[model samples]
Target: MNSFLTSGLIHAAFWVVVGLTFGGAVLAVFPRKIVYNVLGLIVCLSGVAGLFLYLGSFFLALMQLLIYVGAICVAIVFAIMLSPPLHLEVPKRRMGKVVLSAGASGVFFVAIAAVIWKTVWHPAAERGADWSIVTIGHLLLTRYDLVFELISLVLLVAIIGAILTTGFSRRLSS
Candidate 1:
């Protein structure tokens, strides 16, 4: 009975995360307000991190929270706060442009769906059984250290650039 209850809870949690992911994606794209879009992105990233946890990848989940939610989202929020607000009216969408974009998106979606449906997604033949956090950390620090450090450096530069740009804009306005 306990096991059944636990399984049921896990199943429900998975669906909830999935819903959050999809809902957030829609919210992010469809909203005209920049703040709402950022909030939606945060929610979506959080759902992705939760999904990583469900996949038994604690490191991935933690990294997702740290890198995307913690750093990137905070940076974006800072940018929004520092930048001047635009009171420009929303432009009316052109029907022809909208139709073209929609058709392109539909074609891309169909192509992707077909690829996914046709793919034989078997497990790797030599899949390592020992995928513990310790092993992963060791490998990351040893083999992928440069790539990891570069990513961090890039993020740092981006954040710095956003701050500088906003500061310069404020100065120009003043």
Candidate 2:
């Protein structure tokens, strides 16, 4: 493929992924219903998986989909089902509290945006040309292997605890 067409295709893909990610984030934060907010989180996570793909990390993208959208979201769904009935309409907070929260979040956003915009990100002098999953696996296993094992252990414990908690709750309820 020609350089021009290839560059244009990459650019197009980047923008499409960016739009999906930010749009999903907007929906997640702005929605009134908790269910909609959860769905939005799932959508946003999927977009992040797309970004991982664009960054040439297919394994990370798959992990993001599996961990965030699949396991975490399904766990959240289960928790919601196990919880007491939700109010049909969420009660509004006090006007002052709402204003305070909004103002705090807006200020935080501005601060973060200003820092990011002002900081000039200089790329590494010599970036690696190899962006393969095999390299990632080898690197992680050789240099930073402990973290990988720890993460798996933590996930196993969390799954076991979730099951126990849900099971105990059911027995108590009965």
Which candidate comes out best when scored by TM-score? 1
Quote the lDDT for 144 in model 1: 90
Model 1 C-alpha lDDT per residue in residues 1-174, reported as the tens digit of each score: 999999999999999999999998888889999899999999999999999999998888998998899988888898888767676333457899899999999999999999999998866456745667877777778989999899888888888888887776666665
Q: Write the per-residue lDDT of candidate 2 for residues 1-174, one digit (tens) a residue.
A: 699999999999988998989888988899898788888888889999999999998888988997799878877866666564444333445899789999999999999999999998866545744647777767777877898778767876876787787676556555
Error of 2 at 35 (Å): 1.3
Each prediction's whole-model lDDT (CA): 0.87, 0.81
TM-score of each prediction = 0.60, 0.53
> For candidate 2, what is the TM-score?
0.53
Q: List the residue pairs that clash in candidate 2.
A: none
lDDT of residue 99 for candidate 2: 94
Clashing pairs in 1: none
